[model samples]
Target: MKIPGLSFSLKRAVGITSAKQKIARATGIPTTKQGLERKIGGAILNAVIGRKRKK
Candidate 1:
């Protein structure tokens, strides 16, 4: 019998996560929400700091 709260990830079982990580690393792009948020936050911080420094 299957558990009510159990789940399975076919992608993880098939190695898709590794492939995505490889592609993200090679292309300098993020494959996850946290990564994308971090990248965007860094860029925004840099832009604001750069403007302050230029003034």
Candidate 2:
């Protein structure tokens, strides 16, 4: 149940986001949904479009 003026997050209380961020930074990977989607989408687009090669 949620009450007005009351906001609580168990993940935030346990520092899950900070831990995930640290892991992502150490591995050079994304730990968030949007970030992962963006990375994958960019890769797909590049594959479809192809990169220009030097002459």
Candidate 3:
């Protein structure tokens, strides 16, 4: 998501669909599919927020 090296393509691939399954499909990171969704949301949110805050 927002983490460094995270790509827009990756996020888009995950999309707004099922975060868990999408995250798992996008990233091979090993974790509970459930947690991965939150992780993706948090990471992406953080990045977006960080950017906005900077503005």
Candidate 4:
């Protein structure tokens, strides 16, 4: 899954053992399994909708 705040590929950059910690450090968003899934989904939605795009 991609981190909303980070520019690179998080899945590739982070190791399985430290994924949570790395993600938290990058985004300051702590999450459990389900919570992380939700966050990832939200990130994808935001990307699709261009939430940060300037109109």
Candidate 5:
């Protein structure tokens, strides 16, 4: 399955969310969905792309 611009495994997606949450926690950033997306969208996209290319 595909999610528009994102192409990666569910496990990988979960990892991204976990990493982002960690960053948010360390930096005192809000963990809200929109806030996370705004702060780490590029990192999440890059991670997925890099993982996909490896497989």
Candidate 6:
């Protein structure tokens, strides 16, 4: 699944617990079972804006 507002890799970076509880507890994204897929999508967006481009 795609935890909204956070990417899979970013989630792992913050904490690789994988458990929804830990993800929420650490990142405080939210524990609700909703459009979590957005996580990666959100992360991707953030990275695009925030992360530096590699060349």
Task: Please tell me which predicted candidate would have the highest lDDT against the true structure.
Answer: 1
- Rank by TM-score (best first): 1, 2, 4, 3, 5, 6
Q: Which digits, one per residue and each the tens of the lDDT, describe model 6 over residues 1-55?
A: 7777975467666664467776787885766656466566677877789974443
Q: For model 2, how does the per-residue alpha-carbon lDDT over 1-55 read when each residue is reduced to its tens digit? A: 7799999889989999789989999997898889899778877877888973333
Per-candidate local distance difference test: 0.87, 0.84, 0.66, 0.72, 0.71, 0.67
Q: What TM-score does candidate 2 get on C-alpha atoms?
A: 0.64
- What TM-score does prediction 5 earn? 0.33
What would you estimate as the lDDT of candidate 3?
Answer: 0.66
Looking at candidate 1, the ten consecutive residues that score lowest on lDDT are 46-55
Give one digit per residue, the lDDT tens place, for model 3 in 1-55.
3788755666557664467566767887635767778677777988888753221
lDDT (tens digit, per residue) of candidate 5 on 1-55: 6579967678566697788678878987767878767557656776878753222
**Can you give the TM-score per candidate against the true fold?**
0.68, 0.64, 0.36, 0.38, 0.33, 0.28
Q: lDDT of candidate 2?
A: 0.84
Q: Show where candidate 5 strays beyond 4 Å.
A: 1-14, 31-55
Model 4 vs. true fold: TM: 0.38
Q: Count the backbone clashes (under 3 Å) in each candidate.
A: 0, 0, 0, 0, 0, 8
Arrange candidates, best lDDT first: 1, 2, 4, 5, 6, 3
| Model 4 lDDT at residue 48 | 93
Clashes of 5: 0
What shift in Å separates residue 16 of candidate 6 from its native position after superposition?
22
Residues 1-55, candidate 1: write the lDDT tens digits: 8999998999989999999999999999899999999888877988888753222
lDDT tens digits, residue span 1-55, model 4: 8777868556656666487677878886765777678777878988899785333
